[model samples]
Target: MPEFTYDMLVIGSGPAGQRAAIQAAKLGKRVAMAERRGVVGGACINTGTIPSKTLREAVLHLSGYRLRSLYGASYTVKQHITMEDLLFRTDHVVRHEIDVTLHQLMRNDVDLFNAHAQFVDPHTLRLIDLDKRGTRAMRHLSAATIVIAAGTEATRDEHIPFDGQRICSSDDVLQMQRLPHSLAVVGAGVIGLEYASLFAALGVRVTLIDKRQRLLSFIDAEIVDTLAHHLRENRVTLRLGEEVSGMEPFNDVSGDRVRIQLASGKQVVTDAALYSIGRTGATNDRGRISVNERYQTNVPHIYAVGDVIGFPSLASTSMEQGRLAACHAFGVEATSVPALFPYGVYSIPEISMVGRTEEELTAEGVPYEVGKAHYREIARGQIIGDTIGLLKLIFHLQTHALLGVHIIGDGASELIHIGQAVLSLNAPIEYFVNTVFNYPTLAECYKTAAFDGINRLGGVRQDAVATSSRN
Candidate 1:
């Protein structure tokens, strides 16, 4: 019985929780993870990242968003797309993600428990099984170390009435039974913008409302401007620097509609509203726990990671945080997270960046030169009908060392990795200039941008070498 007790226990099966348990099991520790949902992959796989991205892909394909420019503005790949059409792909992807996560845990010999976990003490946890009807089964378990990767929940305010129909949260969007003709997105965060762009691509009139003057202020300003331009071109309305005062349901011939009143004495009526203002840590009543650099809570043996830790709550970063926490718990030395990691926003046309932004470098008084490569200049861009995409590279004016890479357009998320690799190695601009790349590919943009940067610095132009390459 003593041996059966877990050496490490992780609550929540998100990217963070899954990685934490796997890391602990890899260290030959008895590891177990408890998830409230019957599924293993937590919110990321079930509702947040995986499902939303899948839905976006489906919307893009069925709506003929990419082919619109070449085929004409009125052309649509599919005319009568329904909610089921979008959810079919999303459901399939989510199930596959959950299965993959389960397989990973099983192969690593990590025990899985389906229950809501609550701390009875520092080391002991009470697991309540709500799956059983009429009777709630409870089990108590003791672990040498505990990880609270419970993630976060979509915040709900009492002032707003969310019916999961007329007005819904981001999570509720996944469970929507039908698509609305028009939608008013009440937030302009990543999730809000992604959904707004997706729906707009599907021919829905989307109005994005936010109190802030800009969207995703953490991103490079130029990239944000490009995204804003694309959103406007797609016919998505922006209502920035305006606060929503209240909402009321109105009955119309088209069915139920939401009248959103703004603090600036304005009103907008839409078929539905998506309220995606923020999220709160799902750590039950205990809330977010404080952690040290090693991800250890004040109660030494306890740790927290992922969205529960707050800020930059990306699935990729969450996975790393979980692995690092496990390493620290087992006294294993782990490499610190890199100073620069890529951030991929899955909005229509996409946006990705790594390293420091131009704004940050300028504010820090770091001398840098900017190099840009528009997709129109790349052969593959025309082939794929993404001529509006742009890649910007920032490098040290003196050292020619790669400083930042920002991209906004189709496949921007995929293309940013090349820049990330160069940045991680602290490689100089000449690396890209001298390196041979496959012709007629988006990857060639790096070479072009590098040459453009070198030329701006008055270095010898390598344009002849790049131009002479075979496609």
Candidate 2:
């Protein structure tokens, strides 16, 4: 005789769901979470974030990509790398992350359910237990507050044959056995760009196609241009403004190949295809819920967060959304600052951005001046051999206040935070000019860029510049 009851119940164990459950538990409220995969961390840990990044590192190291500037192009650490070598680190890290997440949930005293959950009523869910014997035992769980964070699955075309081998979806790409000589990445989103960059570093010819004419329209045009140039240099073919009308997977004497037909009467035949067109929600729409300032739905007790709620679906923003939702549901009083949430794309020489973009500032008719730091000019950047790296800082022309931070280089994701902190505090460019940083560090780029900007504004005496640099 078991009664499954709680104050809050989260449907998925992803970043958003995990954070939501922990927040409610800390409030002394009964909390439980259901994960259909029988794993504590959802796609973010098991497949998406951890596996992809780990794979990138493996490719970069084995191929000697980062050190090519110093050691020459043919200086690979390993002569020939196999799928086993790539998966070795990814599998190990994923297992460790799962253990860590499970321990955190247990430490927080949140009940865990390894079952698929569906709402029987507005406030109740029928959790279908995942069983190996094909016999599923069901249970009804009731809660005062409910959160839907089931995440999403890769979208695949029915017309295209996907056996998880020669042709596969983004989710199945990691489970692949053999490495192909060529790859056709049929999307230009963050996932597609990252995967294309990784495989290209491994000497795979990558043809990246998309319906859009430009890459990352949200990113700064200058940064995108640099990335595009670098990608082309790495032997990645950009097929922008192309539409895939049809696809057929076939076998020839040379083995398997997928022939993709474009709308403009062109054909692309590649050894493998990673169909990452988009992601679709795994659960029902929950009555096509409209997400608002608060994470509440039309139904009083139900709430939605994370990728399920749509755009800017980053794990960073999703975690904050989950915490805010839990606080709002309990009337604990909280506020969200969407402007401060940073975006990081995990591509080769990954791009990270915060605050306004140059395009946005120009569109708004805001007066601004651009300050840029090239990695080649910095000591650390030369040591790292990231000559193409660039960091752009946008500041208001008159106020001299920092308006935006955009970086495309090595450790761009980590370095963006320094600019983010300054932007969040509404600090001026002089703060960077006056601040003293450790010598031979990438952080010195901030000081370099600040001086560059102040010089652009004109009227600064050499004495004044020297005095500020000393301080």
Candidate 3:
């Protein structure tokens, strides 16, 4: 084996890069991670997941969205909510999370390089020092294995003049001076909808525009509809099937405003706009490289994971990807089950799903039946003042096995794991039906939905169940 500065070199200190470096260190390999940001957690802890989620929580609390059911329709926790109020909680949480990431990496013996890593060659990386305290402006790093988890940057249109305040990208949302009285969010993708919901929750008039006629087409249609309805209830205007022709920013006596011209000749004037069309690779457009089952790129020693790989660009899945890639790089036995992973959208109401959607099963011509439990009927929902929540369980009608589970509402992200377990274990609906969940809890929805499904089956069951019933 050729000598190298480190056995594993991880680019970016996001969830994936952090996990990869830590896993390699645990394997007794010299691991080092290069982070362009002065902080360790990358976008996940700073601009992306942690900040957004904390902002959402702060919005929910200050806006009184969580307890609106118990109180009146016009109820509010605070009469005046400011950007500083929201950022107070968000900044605290983000700083703590960054500390945690930094501490974890330090304890694991992963050397940190606060520098931008440029590919010098297949086995070498040229680091551009970001901090002036560095003795050298640039340095070279060599490693036997490399993992590309630099994550992504928000994509911007050339025409939209972004001043970071009025016209901002998803990456700069946290940097806003103040909350806009109205917001225009272009593109109804996950990031768009998530930000739309957040601002809408804080009493901002949010107009969500997307070229696609439907919102979250990949999600279960019913769940999307429910989310759309909730957004509407929160005064978020849905402008679907609208293509933005252009944006004109003008400064008035009062303040700056932007007029978004649509292809349909309709125009919308807003205080600010968030251009969240999509994201691109942070380091390079290396997605063209082929990655095998082990997450190895065409360059076998190089691996890619997380948002850099696209599709399920989630912090949770990215961590698993990094772990698996590190293990595979070190010749450790590892397995991957991408199908069983859960997709959670951290919007206002929150949405989570595991396994196939009804649309997917229908397109595949698979025989399936759905059973639903509404939060309005659940004791926990009533106690928590959440009435619009719903849990849906899809079962293979003939086999009585769990096919999919989808939930929209409070704790949907946490609740989806129950169904994920059943789907992964190939457990039938009977598992939920027979199992006991705590009273006055959201988990009871599983039992309720499962029984609802079994009842619809109308005594029809798989041969095994029928035979057992007869005996």
Q: Which ten residues in a row have the lowest lDDT in candidate 1?
A: 462-471
Model 1 whole-model lDDT (C-alpha atoms): 0.88
Candidate 3 whole-model C-alpha lDDT, 0 to 1: 0.89
Candidate 3, pairs of clashing residues: none
Q: What is the C-alpha RMSD of each candidate to the true structure, in Å?
A: 2.2, 2.5, 3.1
- State the lDDT at 44 in candidate 2: 91
Q: Which stretches of candidate 2 lie over 4 Å from their true place?
A: 1-4, 285-289, 461-471
Please report, in order, the local distance difference test score of every candidate based on alpha carbons: 0.88, 0.87, 0.89
Residue pairs whose backbone atoms clash in candidate 2: none
Better of 1 and 2 by lDDT: 1
Q: Tens-digit lDDT track for model 1 on 1-471?
A: 344378999999999999999999999999989999878887899879999999989988888888877897677888888999999998888888888999999999998999999889888899998865746889999898999999988877678989988899987887777899999999999999999999998888999999999999889999999889988988899999999999978998878899999999999999999999988889765666778888898899999999899867899989999999999999999986666889999998899999989889989999999888888888988888887899999999888889999999888899999999999899987788788888788988888887788777665534334432422
Candidate 3 lDDT score at position 299: 94
How does each model score on TM-score? 0.96, 0.96, 0.95
**lDDT of candidate 2 over 73-106, digit per residue (tens):** 6678887788788899999999999999999899
